[model samples]
Target chain A: MTNPIVLDVNNLAVSFQTFEGDVKAVRGVSFQLKKGETLAIVGESGSGKSVSTKAINRLLPVKNTLIESGEILFEGKDLLQLSEKDMQKVRGNDIAMIFQDPMTSLNPTMKVGKQIAEPLIAHIGLSKEKAKARAIELMDLVGIRNPNEAYKRYPHQFSGGMRQRVMIAIALACEPKILIADEPTTALDVTIQAQILDLMNKLKKELDTSIIFITHDLGVVAQMADRVAVMYAGQIVEVGTADEIFYNPMHPYTWGLLASMPTLEVGKKQLYTIPGSPPNLLHPVKGDAFAPRNDYALGIDFVEEPDLFQVTETHYAKTWLLHPDAPSVIPPEEVRRRKEKYQTVRMGKACGERIGGGAIGSGG
Target chain B: MKKYIAKRLLTAIPVLLMISIAAFIMINLAPGDPTNLYVMPDATPEQMEATRRALGLDQSYPVQYMRWLTRALRGDLGISYSTRYPVLPILVSRIGPTVALMGTTLLVSYIIAIPLGIISARKQGTWVDTLLTGGAFIGVSIPNFFLGLGLIYIFAVQLKWFPTGGMLELGGNASILSVLHHLVLPVAVLSTFYIANMTRYVRSTMIDVYGENYIRTATAKGLTKQVILTRHGIRNALIPIITIIGTDLPRLVGGAIVTEQIFQWPGLGRLTILAINQREYPMLMAITLLSAVVVLLVNLLVDMMYAVVDPRIKYD
Candidate 1:
């Protein structure tokens, strides 16, 4: 039997108060995160993926950010209804967040071990001695060498990869059930990014923690996610298992994302880019947000937003092409060939064959 | 760090020497002579010339500077024209009262302004913030001398709650209560600018620190608003403030001069004014050089503080 859902976000809508008007940053976004699952929320900047995740933790600025409508249900309790005092108990203890930019994420004035030990002492009421031991243990667990010596060192003393590892150790200190990483490796170099991602995946498996990974990088999403949710403007346009989203993506926006990613297989000099910018959320578009930028946009796509159309039990896409009366459309040829390549790689992995890292690099 | 401090102190030697020369030249070049303050108007020209020659003021600027520099290097700052006591001894005796008064003022200003600034930043845009910010503007705008007179009028004149001025009563011994009694007005006057400046600084720096990513991380770690503030907010905001306070130490000497004059406080500032007015060349030179040395030492101390507050800053 499939693992039960651990978090259910229903019809979430969020807006930010601005001088111009209220910007509808996240509108009618809904998703489920299963226990021990890695769900990657992929989108370009300002797509509201990060906003939606922050809304779950109520981390948005109290002054201008408003949740117009939403219910973030975690373990049968509506987190939105909980008081900030109660939310404090849930945060770091039940759900911890790893932010982008590790350089700025760790306190410059504080020692790294004390930073990691902070949550432990706060949530578990651990004694200072115990917390220190636990902090050192966490540092070791996150792959930092010589935990005893490094514990007293400040963030600036460590390399980028080591600093990110420190961030992960801090997040995992209280042993939360859910980990939310918001583009955790986007600021690191390519090699460091791979190492960080690998470390996170290993930790996730060992801890059995449900992770909601937010990133704009398809390469990261391809390597780290069990399920993928493609966000456009302020809405989720497509969500399915990683294989289904990679092999049989139905939404035109998802097709664009897949096409735009630079892959080794695509030897052509010209790289594909999405034609136009995301819709301005201040005016609140009447139809689908991606319609203006979509080349395969149908007549009705300009006038109305489509509901999620389920192709399989787990795969759902919101697109006009999924309508019964709409003409059939196909993804670009590049997507089709890449999908075939991923399939072969997957089959080889399933057969326990070491096909090497070249296939995985091309898949990205 | 020690090497950096050594280098700083080494550079200060030339700066102090130049200040001593400038102080000597400016006083000598000015229309006043030290003999005028001491010699009687009815004294004969022979007596005036004898006094000038004895004091070595009749010498050229270079010869006077060399004599003063030699005496200073030997720790003998010559006799004060007004007091007829050794300038070094007089300055040494005055240091205690000035340090105590200014030290208390700075301590009180920091104690009050830090919390007020933090509250202003945390409650930014609220009435509390508005009120505190308004107070800071007024504090910064008001002249210290005017503020000193106003405070004396209210507390000393109207309330009769404290002594009017000076370090202690004329005949009273150095008791804590009497010192505190005298301290109230001068400290209040001296600290007004520091409080205003420090509060505004703390508010601005705290606001900037509140937006930092580490603050968010601290919040996400389930830290209460208070913990997040003390652990992350204040520590980061304190860096720039260290620079402010560190640099402000040298400025305190200038402030003390004005404050000391108004209160009749027996401190270096009052002595400085007395020396300038009386044209006590040796005393004035000593005070100027002493101030320059203090400025260099305090700045070096501040740089060291920067390294302490932020481990990322390495002097090496």
Candidate 2:
């Protein structure tokens, strides 16, 4: 049986009003999260992945942001319709967001322990003594050893990995149903990144909390997401299970993003590349924003924006090539080979689970 | 670091020596000698010469400069002309009022500016921020004397709350309350510009610091706004404020001059002016040197405060 939806974002479009012009940031984006699933939104900078998530919490400056039409339903309430004060209450209570730079997300002057207890006091109405004990427990839960001492320390005293762990602790302090982690590990080194990801995976399992992971790293999405949404030029172009996005992406932009991934091949040192830069949002496009750079674009593809067309039972792609009457094509064989590797990871995760209830499922 | 201090001290000595020489010349260059101002016009030239000789004004410029410099090196700043008493005693008697006024102004300005600046910066681009910016504009545009007179009109004349001038009621003696009452107009006059300047500095510093990565993290981590303001923004903002306070030492002293005159507070500024008007070279020189030295000492203090405020900064 499917878990109930915890958060639903429908047809959300965000625009920035500036002296230069209106910069259309996020457009017609929609997605949902099951009660405890990790839904990864992958896209490059300026793709509105960050903006899309910030809108849910009302974190952006109201003067510049115009959320033209959207319904951000979280546990049945329209988050977008709430006042900032009301939203701030909801934030860190029911829906918490962890930013990219872990160090930047935590206040420098406050003790780590106190910062963790803030949301609990504000939202949970916990007393100081009880909250302090719980804060230390959280610090220990997030893999921080010597939790009692760690709580007394400031943000500066913690390492990057430790700081991110602190951020995770604070995010979980209120036990929010949804945790929006925006590139939580992008600022960390590879080894620390792995640790943070592992910690997050463990926490999600333990807490049974859903997470909306915003990142441009396809590799991270492959490893973390149960479902994936590939955003480009402020639109959700193609979205599906990790297998479909990696093995059988229907849009040219997704193909480019996959092709652009740095392979681990030794010494051959070939650099994969996308042909052109992202389309400028200042004066975006009348038709397909990606058409100008897409090599296989046809006459119709250049003039009309493709509606979201069904590709599979759980897959959708917003590209003209996905149209029923259009000519069909497949990704390169190498891309297919990468999909086989991804399938193996899923298989590995499933087999590991056979050992016991404690085993991780096919989420790797 | 020692080399830097040595260089500053070395550069300072020549500037001070030149000032001493200039003071000596201006004091002697008057058409009628200072002694003549004291003696009757019918007195013999011999009597005037005796007076000049007794006061050591009959000596050559080099001899006079040497005498004063030697005496200054020995910790004596010569006698006052108007009072016929030692300049140090006169300065000591009057230093209380000027210092009190300046000290009060400095305290008030900081107390006012810090919160105002933080508030202004926090709501930048909003009406509150615009209002503060506009207020600072008025503060910067107004002359200190005008503001002083304006305060005099409102508090002294119209409301009759504070005295318009003087350090105290004439026979009130130097009690703390009387001193403060007398200090009102002068300190406010001196601090108006300082508070305005400090607010602008504080606002800009806070704005920059508010955007710091750590502040964002702190807010996200759920610290209270007050905690973030004091611990995150205020501590960092104070570094620049300390530096500005250090550099503005001269202005802080110069500002007291006009206020002193207006209030008849009988401070160093008053002493300097009286010496200048009466051709008292020694007293003028002592007051100028004393102001410079106070400023120099404040620079040392500021360097120390920098380290206190920011651990990253160290003065070797």
Best by TM-score: 1
Model 1 DockQ class: medium
lDDT of 2 by residue, B138-247 (tens): 88778877788888899999999998888767786878888788787788787778888888998999988887766665455444577668777787677777888887
Stretches of candidate 1 off by over 4 Å are A338-364, B1-4, B28-31, B40-50, B251-255
The residue pairs found clashing in candidate 2 are: A104-B217, A105-B217, A106-B217, A106-B218, A107-B217, A107-B218
TM-score of chain B of 1: 0.94
Candidate 2 Cα deviation (angstroms), residue A129: 4.3
Q: For residues A32-86, what per-residue lDDT tens digits would candidate 1 score against the true structure?
A: 9999999999999999999999988888998899889989999899999999899
Q: How close is every model to the real structure, measured as TM-score?
A: 0.94, 0.84
- Residues forming the 10-long window of minimal summed lDDT in candidate 1 chain A: A354-363
- Candidate with top lDDT is 1
List clashing residue pairs in candidate 1. none
Poorest 10 consecutive residues of model 2 chain B by lDDT? B215-224
